[model samples]
Target: MSNKIKLTVLGLLITLNSLKAQQTSNKSYDVCIYGATSAGVVAAYTAAKYGKSVLLIEPGKHVGGMSSGGLGLTDIGNKYAISGIALDFYRRVGQHYGQFEQWIFEPHVAEDIFHTYLEKAKVPVLYQHRITAVKKQGNVITEILLESTGPRSVGRVKAKMFIDCSYEGDVMARAGVSYVVGREANTAYGETFNGVQLTNGHQLPDGIDPYKVKGDAKSGLLWGITKGQLAEKGSGDNKVQAYNFRICLSNDPKNRIPITKPAHYQPERYELLIRQMEKRTWKSLQDVFIWSRMPNQKTDINNRNGFSTDMIGMNWDYPDADYRKRQEIWSAHTDYTKGLLYFVGHDPRIPEHIRAEMNEWGYPKDEYMDNENWTHQLYVREARRMKGALVMTQHHCEGREMVQDGIGMAAYTMDSHNCERLVVNGMVKNEGNVEEGGFGPYPIAYRAITPKETEAANLLVPVCLSATHIAYGSIRMEPVFMVLGQSAALAAVKAIDGKSAVQEVDVAALQRQLKENPLADGSAPDVLIDNSDSFRVKVSGKWSVQKRGGYGPDYFLSDGHTDSSSFIRYYPDPNIKGRYEIYTYYAKLPERKAVTAVKVFDGKRLQEVVIKDEEVKVVGQTSGEWVKLGDYIFSGNGKPYVEITGNGEKVAADAVLLVAASK
Candidate 1:
C-alpha cells in the first residue's frame, strides 16, 4: 500500500481503538454536529464558545465546505443580518486585509482563520469521519454512528443533542426525517414564485429566444431545451435550484493559471454555447455582473445577463441525489463549466472577439493553491429542504404575513436566477426569473428552522429550512445561513438545558435570547415618527388630511411625537373601517433630516409604516407613489398609528395620503 494510504489506515486504527475504549467509559458530549460545512463549523464554534462540549465530525477532508471552497465571494444579502460568530469570521477576514495582505481571497488565510477560531474555542473537529446512522431513544437522540475512512472502522458518539449541519442533511436524512426534494405546487401554498419559472427578467435582452433552432419544424426542437411535454402552469416540478463552483480567479500574471482543456473535453458538448455565440446571443463573462471586494483587482463574478455561470434548468436532480449520484453530478458539472471556459478560450467554434477576451483571463494563483490552485468547493444554491415545524413562503417575505416566532431576521430581498428550459409564447423564457427591487427586509421565523416532532428531536436545520423555492432564494445566502446557524446553536443549547425536544422548545424564549444577544455588527438609522413631531399634512379626493397629527378625530391624523417640536397627527374617517389606503403626493422639508419615517395610526396606536433616506433609499420604480417599502404589520404586538417624520421639520411629501375602506 502507498505511504498516504498507510498513514490513513493507521490514523483510522488509532481513532477506532480510542473510540472503542471510550465507549466502555462514560465519555459523553453536550452537543454533536455532523458535517464540517460553513454552517456546521460556525455551529460547532458557537456552541463551544458558549461552554458546550462539541464533537464536530467532518466526513470530507476539508473543514469549510463552500465558504473556504471556491465561493470566495460571499453572498451576504443584508450585511446587518450577519452577527455573532458569523460576523466574527468576516471581521477576521477584514483584519487580514489590513496593511500587508491586501487580497483576502487566499484559501490559506480563510482556513487559518477558521483553525485559529476552533483552537481558541477548544472545539475538537474530527476529519474523515462520516456519520452513517443516528440512533435515537424515545424523544431524544442517544448515539450517532461515525465511520472513519483512514482505518475503515466505525465509531459511535453519544451526545445530549445533535445538529445536522451538513448541506445534504445527512444526519436528518439518516434519522428518517420527513423532507422534500423538488419544487412544490403553487396551489400547495398559494405561492406565485415556487416552481419552474419561464419568464425573462430585466437582465436578459428582449426578443432573444431560448430555443435551439429558430422554429425548426423539420429537425424538431434543439437539445438542452425541454419542451413539447404536457406541463401545467404554476404547478410543482421535480426541479431544484442550480449549483456552481465558486471559482477563485486571479489576473496577476505571476499567479494566474490559464484555462486548460480537460482530459474528457468534448467539442460536441459545447455545440449549444457555440451556436449561441454565433448567433450573438451569448453574454460575455467580463460583461457579467461584477461585485468587487476592495476594488477591482478582485471581484465576485456572479451569474448575470442570460448565459453566465449558473447552470440552470439542469440541477433539478441535486436535491434528492444519493452520494455516488451526487459525485457523478458534481463531476459532470465541473467538466461542463471548465470545458465551457476552455472552449471559449481555444475552441475554433467560438467567435474571434470572445476567444481573444477569454484568453486574457486566467485563474488566481494567489488563491486556493493547495488543489492545483482551483476552488475546492462548489456553490450549491439549493438542496434538500427540511419539512420542519413551520414553512416560510413568499407571503412572509412579501409582508402579506408575519412570523411571530422570529429567532433571527432576514434583511435581503427575495432574489432568484432564471431557471430557463425552453421557448414559450413565441419567445425563449424561464420561470422564477424575478429581480423585483424595493422590498424592505423582513423577519425569518424561528419555527422555520425547527424540525417536525417525528424527525430528530435534537436536530436543528437552519440552512435548509422548511421554505418554498422562492422563499429559499432569499434565505440561501451565506451570511443568512451563518446568522441562522448561530441561532440554531443557541436553540440547541436551550433545548438541551430544558431537556425537551427541539420542537418543544419555546419560540418566545428563543426570540428573547436573540434580542438580548443581537448581532452587534451595525446599527439601524435612528428614524421613528412619534407624537412629538409636528407636520403639514396635505390631502386630496373625498378624504381629509393633516400634517402633524395622527389617527384621531379633529386632529385628522394619529397623535404622536418623535422629537421635540416635531409631532405627527393622523385621523381615520369613520366611514372607512377595516382596511384603509393612503397616498403621499408630495412633502416640503425642514433641515435636520437624517432619515425619513412614515407611520400609520390605528385609533389606539401606531401601525406598520416605512422609513427612507439617502442611506436607505428605495431603488428602482414603484406602482403607486408609495412603493410599499415594508408591510410593517406585526401580530400580537401593536404599534397601530400613522405618521411621517424626519429629524428636522424639513420633510417633503409629493403624493397625497388617502385612506379608504379595505375592499
Candidate 2:
C-alpha cells in the first residue's frame, strides 16, 4: 500500500479509537516528568536527587523507552558530551559487564541497568498510566489528568515543574507546545543535507532500480510507492523518520529460536524483495547487527546489512499518533519486518547463500521472553520535536554557531534513516539516510530541552528536543538523551528553587549548574581529566581506558545487512573466567611529559595477558580489531591494571584499561 493511504487509514483509526476520560485528582507536586523513557528516568532522578518530590508519568507499561526497548544498540554520538546522569548510566552498564562498553549490547542488560538507576534514585514510576488531559493557565500548568489501567485508575495531580521526555512529545503537545514534524526543505534551514536526495551514497543494492519496468516511463510506478502528491525536495512535509523493531537473534543452538512464520505472514508481501534478488541485485549483509557482551556467551542480532528491517519512509505519522493508531502502525511494521525475516530465511526465491546465512541466526530464547521473542519496543527514531525557546538547527551542529548554554555535546555526524523511496532509471531507489563526514562533536543548547514560551512554564523535554529533522537525527542518541535528561531535571529544580518558569530560568546560572553537574561536556573544574571517543565512553576530567576489538563472525559479523561499517561483536571469551576490579575515585594529578612506557601492575609487579589482534573486515565499512585477553592473566587483588602517569593537574579515575588492542 502507498504511504499516503497507510497514513490516512492509520489517522482515521486514531480518531475513531480515541477516547477522553474525566479528571479525578487535584493534588500537586514539585516536579512531573512525562514519558518514561531513558531521558524521563534521568530527569526524575535528577529532580529527586535535589530533594524534590517527583511524579513520573509513563504512557506505557515499560519505563525505559528506546533504551530498554529493542534498541539495544545505543546511538550515542559523542560520549564526552554526555555527563552527569547520562555518564552514570553507561558507567553502570560497564560495571555490569566488568568491561568497557559499546553502543550495541543485549537488551536485558540495558533494562537491568536502567531499572537499577530508577531504584537507586527512588523515583515513583506509574506505569500503564497515560496522560488524558493537561490544563494550563497563563504561564503555569495547573494539573494533568492520568488514567490507569487498573481499578480506581483515574487520578489527577498538579506539579510545579513538568518535563516531556517522550519520543513523540505527547506531553508537550497536550500542553500546547508548537512543534514541527518531518523534514524541512533545504531552503528552510540552508542545510545541504536536510531535504530529499538520491545521492546513492547510502542506497540499497546498486542496479536494483525502483521502477518496475526498466527505462520505460510508460511502465508506471511499482507497489509500495505512494502514488499521490510528491513533495518537492527539501520541502516541509508531515513525513518523519522510519521505525523498526530491533530483532534479538542468536546462533546459540541451545537458546536460538528459528524464525517462525507469523499467523498473518503472507509470502506475497516479500515478493518485492524476491524480485530484486532474482535480478541479481540483492542487498548485501554489511551492516547486520551482532552485539557482543563481556562474558561473551550471548548475541544480539541487529540490522547489519542494507535493506535490513528498518521500515524506512513508513513512520511519518507516528510521533503524533494516538494510542490505538500507534498500535496499528506498530502491528503493520511488525508484520512487515517479520515477513522480511521469514522471506529471507524460508522463501525459496532467495539465494541459497543468503538463506543459509539467515538460517544460522534466530531469536535468543533468553531475551525478551515476555514478548514472545520479539523486542518490546519499536525503535522510534524521529518523533515530535517540541519547538522550544531555542530551536537547535543544522547551524548549531556544524559549529557555525555554538550554543552558549551548552548542556551537552554531540559528536556524531548528522545521521538520518532512509527517508524516501523512489525508482531511478527504472531501478528501485531510496534516499534520506544521509551521513556527513569530518564534523566533530558539537555542544547541545540548554534551550533545546525547555518548553516553548507559550507552552507549560515548568516542563522540560530531553528526549524529544527542539531540533530540525536532520539535527534531531544526530541528537536523538541514548547518551545524549541521558545528559539532557539530567540537565532537564537540574533546570526543573533550579526553577522550583527560584519560583520561575523553565523558560525564564537564568541561562548563566543554568550553565554554572550544568558545568558543576556537567551533563553536556565533561569540562569541569572538579573533574580531573576528560576524554571521550566517538560512539564510546565519555568522562568528566577523568581518564578512562578502553580495549577495543571485534568478536568473530559467530560472535560479531564483519559484514551483515544493517550497517556494514558498524563495529559489532557478538561473542567474548567464556572459558577464561576471572573477576577484574573497577575503581571510581577522586584524585590529585601530577604533571609529567609524554608517555614513556605502559605497564600493568598487580600490587607488586607488572602483569601480562595474551593479546590477539585479528584482521576481520565488514564490507563497505571500517575494520575493527578483534582482540582477546587471557582471563587467567588479569585476575587477583588489584589485578589487570594499567599505570599511566602522564601530564595533568587532575583526572577523574573512572575505569582501568583492562584491555587495549591497536587496530
Cα lDDT of model 1 by residue, 84-168, tens digit: 6675676577567652112235554666676676667767666667776788876568888877765444378888888887777
List model 2 lDDT by residue over 1-663, tens digit each. 543564455344222222211221335678888887888888887788778887777666565777777666555543445567676576566557653334555666777676666666666666557887788898678788877763335477688888888777877888887888888888886887787755554455666644456556566665555544445666666676667776667777877788888767877655446554555454443333333331234443454333556666677778878777888899988988787787877888777787787787777776665467677778888888877778888888777888788877776668887766665544566666677744556788888887766666777888778888888877888778877888788888888899887877887887777666553323322222222322222222233332121111011111112221222111112222243322221111222122212234444456443221122111111112112222223233442333322223221222222221110
Candidate 2 whole-model C-alpha lDDT, 0 to 1: 0.61
| Model 2 CA RMSD to the hidden true structure, in angstroms | 11.6
Highest-scoring model, TM-score? 2
Each model's lDDT: 0.61, 0.61
What does the lDDT come to for candidate 1?
A: 0.61
- Which regions of candidate 2 are displaced past 4 Å? 1-26, 100-103, 149-152, 205-222, 228-232, 279-306, 517-526, 530-596, 599-663
What TM-score do all the candidates reach, one by one?
0.72, 0.75
